[model samples]
Target: MSNTGLMIFDGEVLRSIDISLPELQHNITGAQLLEISESKVSKSLSGLTLPPNLKNAAVSQVSDGDDVTFRRTEFNQQQASEKLGVFISAVADTLRDAPVVVSVLDGSMLKMFLEDEDDFAMLAENLFTDLDEEDKGKLCKREIRNALVHMGVDMGVPPLSEFPILDDIIKKHDADGDEELGQAQFAQLLQPVLQEIADVLHEKPVTIVQNVEIFTGSRLRKILADEKTLKCLVTKTILELSNEKDSQGRADPIKTLILSNGKELGLPPLSSENEPVALLYETIFSQLNNRDKQTAADASTEDGLMDSLKDILRKFEDLLETAPVYSATNI
Candidate 1:
């Protein structure tokens, strides 16, 4: 503290940083200003020396979610560390009355907290503000928004004072949902991901065995590759799930169950489960609503045929009531 002496107000560095002759008396706890001149102090202020460990401290405290991507490159990580060190050093060097503090943190904890979403999102929002206007668009906005949403917006993006736009965006997106979730929209969201997963399976052939609703391994791969149909179904499932009476109450769990059940409820199981029964109900109801369409096309042929199919579906439903898992062959 003595290297560059200054008179501070009430021991706060920022309150009064005067480089004139020392003004208070009876303070022997710290360094004495002695006879230092204003010119010498001004020269030292221009120099702005910081503690050597400043960068290390800043690097240690760096949050993981700002897309810093420490694993991306040694150079990038080290550079960030150094730049942060400079900032910390600058603060430490200037603020004589500041109390220095640091905490020991685990890499695992750092990684987990970073991914906790809501917490990271708040951090990203701050990071967003710190970035240049152009830089804000690329890394900050998307990641922060995603993190904010993924956390379920429980408190509605804490530090709400920051992102005024998020509330409106969420409301708008919710309000604008299609009457039913669109298959095309669903396909677009997952198609690329499924394709990537499928590419890995080409090397080792495997079956796309359906497990309830989960598509394990090779099936998952296949679904990713040729998922135009499944994606559409998934989208519709989501839409219906949204419309479900319980939708607003427990969204995540309900959505998860809806998707899991839908993924397994293919053409084979439709005859048994309410999923198919429900679809049939809709189809039958629509047909009943449009007597002209029923009579116009193939009422003499298709109408009775549809009745027989409905009876067959009823029998399948009876069989399905007793089992946890059922297959088409068993039905």
Candidate 2:
């Protein structure tokens, strides 16, 4: 895993980063700071650094929503430099507190195996043996696709769905045909196919997001730790719920509010309809006293609403830390 993807974050490394304008440049804008901060962080997470796609996504996710401090469009030279420092420090602090896990497939591992004669020979021999199941010294060339599947992500071979170029590579070599090949012939056919994939990957790496639930309660904890952010979220949800009332004139349930905003608060999204997630919410809601439920339902003032939201969020923080929930699909 370490060899296949850039490790997520190194707090010490991130904290030590010094952000500034290029030599002779005096000023910077919010957008430029964002670019510099992202570049520095990406560089620090070297080796298997985040591909452009993931890096851009992460930057947008972090800055666009609740963390709006980085969105200021302009600043004088001194202010820009100071704000840049502050933004980088905040990024370091947040990630150090709860780092997001990610993986990248850059095809370097395949290149390594292809470059080493002995390693490539052994890899070919092993693959041939695996595909040859019956001790028949020959295998149909079409088995090349299966061989790539067997190599999988760890070996730097992307899935057919992820990299359609592989299918083209196979057809180009006529390896998808029914022609049979012996061990040496198989090696000959595989070498060029792998080389082509490595070249393609060098140009365009894929960032893979595992679809596993995060049970760390990190997002919930972060929001809970910041009273201002938590209050803002509660206020925002309340307004949204009010605007989203049904034709019957009934406001959405507090539970619905929780479900709708789950992902932001470190729980699973409501759209998953995952049974375990539904059950978890049911358990939490069911256990709340009738008076507590009534209070949450009837609350109209900001303080009352905030208290109810805090209680519910605290429950989520505890339960999510104990159980996994559905997350976004892996890509």
Candidate 3:
């Protein structure tokens, strides 16, 4: 009888297999293997077919003796942007007319009525009557927890003597540091995240200007022609923004937004010196401010685009050291 033992090697080591050669005889003929050399086994077996299920399945190769390998899917920017947009819209709509107190400590845990319109109205009315004169429109830690409990929201944590988490939540959202949360303070806590989400959702194409005086005009053309000078100016603008700090000593969000928008608009790896980074900043700032003006007239709009833009501009204007100033002469 012909020697029936068939060994399979994955890079010099034999791989374990429970199936016998008789099972694969129809797909891989003994005559075929006898004709091929040991070095040619891998190439010859490439055309061999296994069971239909196994043939269609994806098989991964392991070279470093690892039993398994993971394949990660590429990040899809467009899909992520769309999902963030939907989430932002949903949150904005939920809080538009509701007495919501979003936790600043854990911003993801928003406190809003999940009931129907009529139920919410009744709950608000009942809650209002229970409120003391001093706490009429404000929610303290105890009151917030009670309200949550009434709304059937489970805290999910083991009962503690004082629920220290509530204190942290109050401290973060309490703008005046009074251990309570008001509508205005709640909105403030929510604004930054909402603004970022809006920015991602409403990403417009970068307006590339060719005939602009600042970029293509006589004086700018000379400065921009030197690649080194252009790169220096762009780097300087970013550094200026990076050095700016807010009241909390954190990097200013408006400047951060401007820089982020600039990157998305392809400002860093500038295709041409004719596309001035300064113009990109100016364009983003103008578009944001103009959008605010247009949306401000509507008081009932849920997107809060106008409010978000105003907040960003207020921070931008308050920056003691502004972006590098550029002057343009007519063509």
Candidate 4:
């Protein structure tokens, strides 16, 4: 049996694991999870029955507060599998702006709303698809990729293998019997798991933006040997808060959206009135900047919330370096 992570969008659920025939182990067989589906377990398994000993197939869905009743199992796993990625792409887009509102106990309308949410694309898809014409992004690949990575994690591939600044080095041998990277068997082991997770996450709309570039080390040996080059990377997103208007209950709602690198030295807040949109860009523009000097790439994003959180940590460490914001009354 496999332990899996899943996300739900509307009538569809996005998955992080691939459910395949080979993976239908006895442990996860009976355990089932139901989300916003018109399909009934009885109906779907009518012809394709679960083994009598099946035990732990579970499912979950994210709520947006809509109510509905799923009486019949009308969903076909095969059909659901085909459209999973497309479904997830839609939900991802909707959630980026704001969470989709769901009403409790209104399953019928909720299903209808989910069906209508099909066209909304996810942010992960947006970032990748926008540049899709130029090239593929680490995030924008098929749900198959997502499944493979997750399965790889289960099989114990270090998550660091996916990092832009990292390399997934697979040596020719390990006494532990784990398949080495690039082996035909290793690739094959991932196929089923990949398909399942891809099917699921393709249904959910939540997008976790990880560092993008994923070309492996051997894929970059010549470039790294140094022809003296510069490149740009997103270090961390910076946000500046503002007191626009106080809500009846809440102190003050966010009035701005600022995405910064936090290195402009001294840029003033754009406003205290309305929402703001700002983005900070860090680049490797000169030959000298490419040298082994202190830079954003050397920083750690593997653990921190923001890319340059070290900077924030240092600032907070020194109390003398902080200042108070202007109060609403003062403004």
Per model, how many backbone clashes are there? 3, 1, 0, 43
Segments of candidate 4 deviating more than 4 angstroms: 1-182, 209-331
On TM-score, the candidate that comes out on top is 2
Instruction: Highest lDDT: give the candidate number.
Output: 2
RMSD of 3: 26.9
Model 2 regions more than 4 Å off: 1-8, 23-29, 47-72, 99-122, 125-146, 158-184, 195-331
User: How do these models rank on lDDT, best leading?
Assistant: 2, 1, 3, 4
TM-score of each: 0.15, 0.44, 0.16, 0.17
lDDT by residue (tens digit), candidate 2, 1-331 = 4667734453567677776656535555567767666667666655334444445445555455434665656667666556566656665665555454555778799989998999999999999999999999999999988999999877888788768888889999888988999999999999999999888888988665444444455567777787986677678867776676483665544565566666666666554367777787777768654555557566555677677777777887788767645454564
lDDT of 4 by residue, 163-236 (tens): 22112111111112322323233333333332333333334312221111111122123322322221121222
What RMSD value applies to candidate 2?
Answer: 10.1
lDDT of each residue in 1-331, candidate 3, tens digit only = 0011112211211122111222222332222322221213223222222222221121211111221321122213343233223322332232222111111111111212212445434554555445535756765534543443343212111112223343344345432233666644443343332233223323421111111211112222233245554344345544554566653564433444345453232123223343444454556557554655445333113233233433443433333124322222242
In candidate 1, what are the lDDT values of residues 1-331, reduced to their tens digit?
Answer: 1111211211133223333333434322101111122223323333222233432332334323222443233333334334333333344443332222211111222233344657544544554444324542333222333434433222222223333443554343342233322323332322232232223323322221111221113232333344455445445544655577873453432224223554443223344354644554355335444555544233223333333333333433443332222223421
Flag clash pairs in model 1. 55-85, 194-224, 208-219
Regions of candidate 3 where Cα sits further than 4 Å from its true position: 1-112, 115-118, 133-163, 175-331
Lowest lDDT sum, 10 consecutive residues, model 1, at 1-10
